[model samples]
Target: MPSEIKLVNVPALGKTAGYSHLAEVRGGRTIYLSGQIAVDAQGQSVGTGDFTAQARQVFENLRLGLESVGLTFNAVVKLTVFLTDMQYLPQFRAVRDEFVNTAQPPASSLVQVAALVRPELLIEVEAIAAAP
Candidate 1:
């Protein structure tokens, strides 16, 4: 929706709920964001041991990063989410939904890991976006 990025969900699979199966990009400058953790401007952890709060902070951090480059969440074509616990997914989706467009969600993947750089950190998110 931010330009030529297109969301594609094949009929062969079940209809996607929160994310598109594929993102088709015609042409644009691709931006790859570094993994964003739930840290504030002061580099302080925003929500220690709280999955939902950490997720919200991560999205906010990502938003700021995108803004710095003259892009918005709408320009995002792909996202990768990392979590320490798999059970936090439903809660993460709830928070993520607030930031991302459901009608044209980006290609996404969620992975559960043993731990992050800090034990208190619960989640991390990174994105790939395209802009003209």
Candidate 2:
């Protein structure tokens, strides 16, 4: 875990469903990753027309992006999630929890969009991470 980046779930904001309310970074290099969709390196969709599977794929994609910079999921401080449907919140959380650290969850935002770059894509996620 990177001490420069800390995640805090303040009480002022109600209970967190699976993310921290705030993530404060002390001093480190920050990386902003472009929104990652549910597509494999081969340019094929991993999970087509499936919210949960696509959500899982998105997290894995994020993980790989961070790993390229020698950072793990804990190094991530914030995540911006875009979903095609808001009703898939429960399913998305379930898959997100599998990749995100519950003890040091990242600050997050979920936005329901009318659609994504592709109709088959149900989820896209962008991440911010810090590395010392």
Candidate 3:
């Protein structure tokens, strides 16, 4: 993470298993990324009916998006994750951990939605990053 970014797991807010309770960024460019799904560069769906595979692809898309803006996962301060079913939380966390900074994880929100832009899509992720 950068010196301009601060991640906090507030004791008052209770313990967080894989995300921070709050993130503070000072004097940096804030980047907002659109939600990324399991579609590849060619717009082909990468995973069908596979939650783990779809989650990995979603994170990969996020990684690419971050790279495009000259940033990395460490620059991410917040994440908004949407899933078709909450039962896939564990799988989602496992894949997300592979890409994000575990030591200083970003503040995050997880939502269960009925559907996405594509019915085959199982997960979607959006991010907010700050760079010095």
Candidate 4:
């Protein structure tokens, strides 16, 4: 393991799921990625109701974003997923499993929201990473 797991408390925010209110990983290289949507390099939506297509695009964007910082998906210690439709989660997860290491899934959170910057976009993902 590159870092120790930390439990962060935010009394004001209340409790979450199996995860802590927040997580802290000891340092190496840290990367903060902006939320990635289903948009392609040209900023066009890749998938409409097709969660798999959108998920693939999201991971591709994430991979490129990570490469820009000299890291990979394996370096990710945390991930936050925001979705306009919660019903698509199973589809997202199935596709997501193909991109990430199953043995060591990162600490993660999934949030369902009503909308995003664009109405056609259904999902957004962001990540935090630590690596040596």
Candidate 5:
């Protein structure tokens, strides 16, 4: 069955930048996760002051986030990443590659932001996933 797409809108903000208001997956009966941060299972920051390490931790957290909704990287159709510094792009991409198979890559976007939730966080990612 085809899943329906609705703009994702979290109550915290009336709107967001470059994201749907709220994404609703109907037929899929599955959840499409937003790219999560490098916070560990305990909700503690994983990568501090290191972009590469932070990037790796971010992907790991992404993996767990997807799993939380009964999905995996293979189910992801797109990903948007926000980084505090563009200079870390290459290194971050390398770390990201370890999680996704490139033969059929998901659509992706990377943007440099003035800052993240914390001063030490170098990157954050959000994603859209599909289910059978």
Candidate 6:
């Protein structure tokens, strides 16, 4: 982690499962990544009906996005997750933990929606990162 970034788990907010309560970044370049779905470079869907597969592909896309700007998952400070159904929460967490720094995970938000731009898409994830 960069010296300019700080991850905090607010005592008042109680324990967090896999994310921090707050992420503070000072003197760094902030990067905003668009929502990533389970799509490959050729614009083909990677996962059809499998939520876990889709979630993994989404994270992989985010990883590539971060790498494009000379950063890694460690530089990520926040994540916004959207799921077509809340039932996929457990699967999402499992996939997320494989990529993020769980010890000092980034602040995160999860929202359940009725559907995505594509019916086959089960999840979408956007991220914010800070790099010195």
Leading candidate by lDDT: 6
Looking at model 4, residue 29 earns an lDDT score of 62
Candidate 2 lDDT (Cα, whole model)?
0.88
Span of ten consecutive residues with least summed lDDT in model 5: 15-24
User: Poorest 10 consecutive residues of model 1 by lDDT?
Assistant: 1-10
Off by over 4 Å in 4: 1-24
lDDT of 2 by residue, 84-131 (tens): 888888998888889889877889999989989988998899999988
What is the per-residue lDDT of model 5 for residues 1-132, given as tens digits with 9 covering 90 to 100? 134533344668664333334344556644456667878878888768778888888888778878887777766667889988889878976887888755445656778999888777889998777776
- Give one digit per residue, the lDDT tens place, for model 6 in 60-87: 9999999999999999999999999999
lDDT of 3 by residue, 16-132 (tens): 989999999999799999999999999999979999999999888888989998999999999999999999999999999999989999999999999999998899999999999
Candidate 3: C-alpha lDDT:
0.93
- The local distance difference test score of each candidate is 0.91, 0.88, 0.93, 0.78, 0.71, 0.96
Query: lDDT order of candidates, best first?
Result: 6, 3, 1, 2, 4, 5
Cα lDDT tens digits, model 1, 1-132, are 755777888889888879999998887799999999999999999988788889999999999999999998999999999988889989999999999998879999989999898878989899999987
Write model 4 residue lDDT over 79-131, tens digit each, in one string. 89998888987788887787776655677889999998888888899998777
TM-score of each: 0.96, 0.94, 0.98, 0.80, 0.75, 0.98
| Candidate 2 worst ten-residue window by lDDT | 1-10
How do the candidates rank by TM-score, highest first?
Answer: 6, 3, 1, 2, 4, 5
Candidate closer to the true structure by TM-score (higher is better), 1 or 6:
6
Off by over 4 Å in 3: none
Q: Candidate 5 versus the native: TM-score?
A: 0.75
User: Which stretches of model 6 miss by more than 4 angstroms?
Assistant: none
The better-scoring model by lDDT among 2 and 3 is 3
